[model samples]
Target: MKLAKHIKSALAIAAIGAASSAQALVVDGVTWNPNALNDFSATDAMYESIVSNIGDVVSGYSLVTQLNGTASAVFCPGCELTMTFTGYQLANVTLMADLVTPDQYFFTGGTINIYVDSTPDADFTDPTTYGDGILFLSLAAHTMGNGYTLISSPTPQVGNTGNGTGYLDVVGGSAASNFNTNKYGFAYTGNTAADFLFTSQFQLITNDDGDPVCLSSVNDSPICMQGANTINGNSIPEPMPLALVALGLFGLGLQRRLRRD
Candidate 1:
């Protein structure tokens, strides 16, 4: 992803096509413009493992791909972000949808536990004080039910990196760059009441590849990110039909599972 970062994601989706699809930036109710990924290409896949969802191990990798031909588009779709790193200080990103819900989430702070599903792995519970609640989703909705896109918060404290979300022990800034945050960088754009959207643009490229410092901020986001590190590009163009049954069931790998091993 570097035609100068696709011209910085095509000028951040052309500022969501000059905004006003109700403050544009959505996926399920469909409004995300970046021409809804016109020229959407593929090759994405990645995998690693340490596993945790508030269990604290927080390091597993999976990057599967699909979203067929015909220039695609779909939105406010929930879950699929798992970031956290060191060196560049990107420290939190978990909007998960591994689907495991039985419903029973509670966390008091230091010694109160009860997690069923939806990105919870800190080995003791503390996803940066757990504030954005849907508790980091595990399919709370929008599996085509037509609702549920997510963008979370709470992971402040950048410079010396002492926020809440990412706290794995890289001792530099593994998970401790803050968690589940995404202030700008990729220059977000999910309005129409955006529920969630990140089909797969897994980020992180700074060793001089440039664009880090917590994504340089539209607000801020960092802490735990993953990518099989495969990338290619181009497009598709379905305005609706539920965005062609939500990316044709993610290009028939059935809600994503083309390859993860």
Candidate 2:
């Protein structure tokens, strides 16, 4: 993370210091941009095969690190997100997690399935229109239990790219459960009403084959994935009240000193 970005984040949190406890369990407005990635390419009469095989590429990579990031302050696992990507192909995408607390988090049971524009690939990109194109992905609530659930929405269209949107929830436990989704990205477990707090800092990898419009790597490997993509800074409670308490005592002491003088 850059120093300026860190300052901005701190200031943002400070600005919202007095919002309320309920809203405090949230990290907002996090962004990640890869400094360098490879482009993609494809051969003649092989566009369809390339698209289908892109998943192979997407699955091979993982998010490496975050340029600017934070760890989760609270643990609530029933958290999920729908990330939208613009100017990028939809077929070759992947999500990775960084466990804040390994034993407490699980994203998609170790695997993430993709959706195109809110519909399953089988339906959205049917054999007819299943050609090559960019689309949005939606995260669904698949893993549900007393202590955990997933939440997510489709990303809207942005310019030529799609906007990704997602949600996180608390399924079980309380704010102090010490079990949080603040894993690398968005991965955790929660019970009904558990306070889930997550910091968006991780990777978004894409499978880029050798195509004219692909992201490639320096080693001639396609930029199959984007690592360490941060979003919605991790939400943590600010101890402003503790500071206020100390300040109040100081004020009282100062008043007493003046009276004695």
Candidate 3:
């Protein structure tokens, strides 16, 4: 009995040590250290995939990273990251008829800004210049919206690409011009109610011009776009280390009681 108790106690100690070593590295709300960008395989893939699959219909798209709270003193505490999706596809399906005859678009170049609130401050717009708490990606011109939206339903469709909601607006132009410059805007809301999960599903609209079309707001339509392809299912932070420590303590206590018996 004494030998068995000793073995159990040793196991418990090992578990405690293992748990401590496996603790995740976190700064602010982000899990991946921006300084060590190359260390995160998933994040690197996400960026590359977005650029490579520009014209392909994006089935699952999500990019999640931590903001650098230490970079700026004005940064909001406990502020969550946000993304917005706006364009013709997100609008009412019926509005498709209103689009140009070719009914195709390509991605050009654009910038996505991360802000603590809906309105971005001037300092937060450019990642290259800002030097902290920013993410920059090379996106094609015609790409619609990218990101995730929380649903009230308890069980979210994990891998379903068309699972969320979107709206529509008019992109008006003559047949010759094709309203090439007009573009739509999708905005993200920072709500820290849950862990951050960025997701998107996109279909490339090929056109004769082969140039990107900018989104122009004309009117609002009901939910149109749905389905997200890539979801950061692992975005949620793990439970506190105390929980593991407690389990270790429980094992130790059990071993002590058995030895006493």
Candidate 4:
């Protein structure tokens, strides 16, 4: 009886420890464990373009005149970039961008689209055809010819930065499993005269509208969002721990019956 009681007590302690350890999920200083479900999104914008200059000024003895300053260049009208992350755990994931542009030109009109999914061994070859799970798609107007712009989506929706650096806290979900499983895609539309230049980053975080915690980049970082509430997926509990818990409960019940007898 004494052995049984001790076994039950030990099991109870073990269960408590497991629950406490998995209570909160933290990534890049952002707490993803939320009592209620929440979604966050943001975007960053920049500029990139090719330029060619022609003509020079010539001085005359009697007349003063300004010569030509004509230029022409080809820019990237539309392009798609996709990234697949493997062996990374994520939940309450937020799409982040750090956009950079040239000094003279800015992103006139375009959209930055984001897509995410947990399908194992998924392929993101073509944007038009590869449409499985899309979290959020954002749109923005011209920035009044500003050199740079920083923005976040779904929440703030519009950004008001001119340096081409911004952050957004968008979407919430669990981690993706399997090798080469998780995939992210980016589609960019540049202005008529110039192409947009920028870089993107992803982070695992909860709602930050009240208290914002922004990240510049999540590459090569051991931070990802995962679990229930955030990703609508079952958190895999350790079998050993569960088995031990069950055994402990059985011993406790047996001890009680013996006492009753």
Candidate 5:
């Protein structure tokens, strides 16, 4: 009876751990550190565009410039550029961008259009969709026409920052842009802590002229750049999936101890 009780206790603890692990799906990739400003801006820091042609699971990692910042902050019509992120999964998708220096750098503002495999409410369970799956943005004191616009701070969404984070219709224009190379994409955390799986930190200007800058030579366009990325789901080994490991270990240990007894 004592051995049976011990085994049952271990099994119960294992089950609980498994349940907690379900909180999020894990994704494997080069851990992008926001604090590593210099490394984050380097060409090697951006998420590599995963081509769908291959048997790759996740889709393309692309960027669309909705509007090219002008001498002022007004977005000129017909100046927006859109880049489709192919093979995009509905799970937690985190997009990141950064600028360096302020010379020739103008106010960079824009909307990021996100097309998920599932609906907003279905994918991210949240009272407000603002951060759940969509986000709006704006930044002040943003100078335009500069070579690099360094991110000294993490600016949240705002009215004039751009437009509201609305549902992206399959046919209509899904995103807008105010700044060219300073915008980014991330999951909404206002809902639940589980929704925070795909969060990204910001790194300020690290190197001077050596700063990593993503730029659009044409002013309004997705800046073509190369970088390495490894995306793994919670099913993979990571903090998000640690519960599964603990449960397995506990179960195995319980079995061994019972056999010995």
Candidate 6:
């Protein structure tokens, strides 16, 4: 009996070590992360269109939920709001851009669209349909490394202007996030059905290698990455705050010690 228990412990340790190995998913020649493991729960997906043939789910992962920076965390109904996030990698992907050279850099990105409804009872359970929520905020983001975290400060969702359908316009950031790039946020003009970013973390994780999956053999191929993710759910300000960080903020001897989960 003791021998069997010792064997299990040894196996568990070996598994952990193996998973720690630096590994990512790839398809053909593109290294794209897959949300297959999480059962296709990518709220917003990113892709690189090299002139054409743009795949929506370029191995997408995770969902989104923002928090209000307040003590009571009350829902003001029509108060102005701002958003900030320490992003994370729900899945890993691989893709070589056409302009990417030996030492050149490339990009893969996603989007977040918002809506406003004065109904007072807005429901966003369905990001696609937004159950009861109306379109109000819409923004796009891009990343260069495995994951991204916005600057420690909060900005408004006024990027590119002439639009207010979406927000979280993080077009550029880095891996370690040791530098404050051109990361800015947006805000609602008069405020009403819109405020800071909403909700708790939720998502589905999957492999990105375009392998067999939960509903494979049905014709189409689903590509996902190997990793865990959050269940994407949008919401208004609740009483209690949600802390969805995994490994805490990366604290190296560098720039802003932003959250790296």
Best prediction by lDDT: 3
Q: Write the per-residue lDDT of candidate 4 for residues 105-160, one digit (tens) a residue.
A: 22222333333323322221222222334322222222322322332221221221
lDDT (Cα, tens digit) per residue for candidate 2, span 18-86: 344323232222122211120000001001111122222112111112223321111112221122222
Q: Rank the candidates by lDDT, best first.
A: 3, 4, 2, 5, 1, 6
C-alpha-based local distance difference test score of model 1: 0.26
**lDDT for each residue of candidate 1 in 1-261, tens digit (9 for 90 to 100):** 233444445444544443433233332222223343432222223321221234222222231233322212232123222222112121234444654422211111111111112332322112332222232122111111111122222222222211121111111112112212222222223222112223322333233544333212111222333233221222122233344344344444431342332
Using TM-score, give the best candidate's number. 3
Model 1 segments beyond 4 Å from truth? Answer: 1-33, 36-55, 62-64, 67-261
Report lDDT per candidate.
0.26, 0.26, 0.30, 0.27, 0.26, 0.25
For candidate 4, report its TM-score. 0.24
What TM-score against the true fold does each predicted structure earn? 0.18, 0.24, 0.26, 0.24, 0.21, 0.25
Instruction: Name the better of 5 and 6 by lDDT.
Output: 5
Cα error, residue 50 of model 6, in Å, equals 24
RMSD of 3: 17.5
Positional deviation of residue 202's Cα in model 1 after best superposition, in angstroms:
17
How many angstroms is residue 114 displaced in model 1 relative to the true structure, after the best TM-score fit?
32
* Model 5 score (lDDT): 0.26
Count of backbone collisions in candidate 1: 59
Q: In every candidate, how many clashes are there?
A: 59, 53, 35, 25, 41, 52
Q: Candidate 6, residues 33-59: lDDT per residue as tens digits?
A: 222232111222211111112232222
Candidate 5: where are CA atoms >4 Å away?
A: 25-251
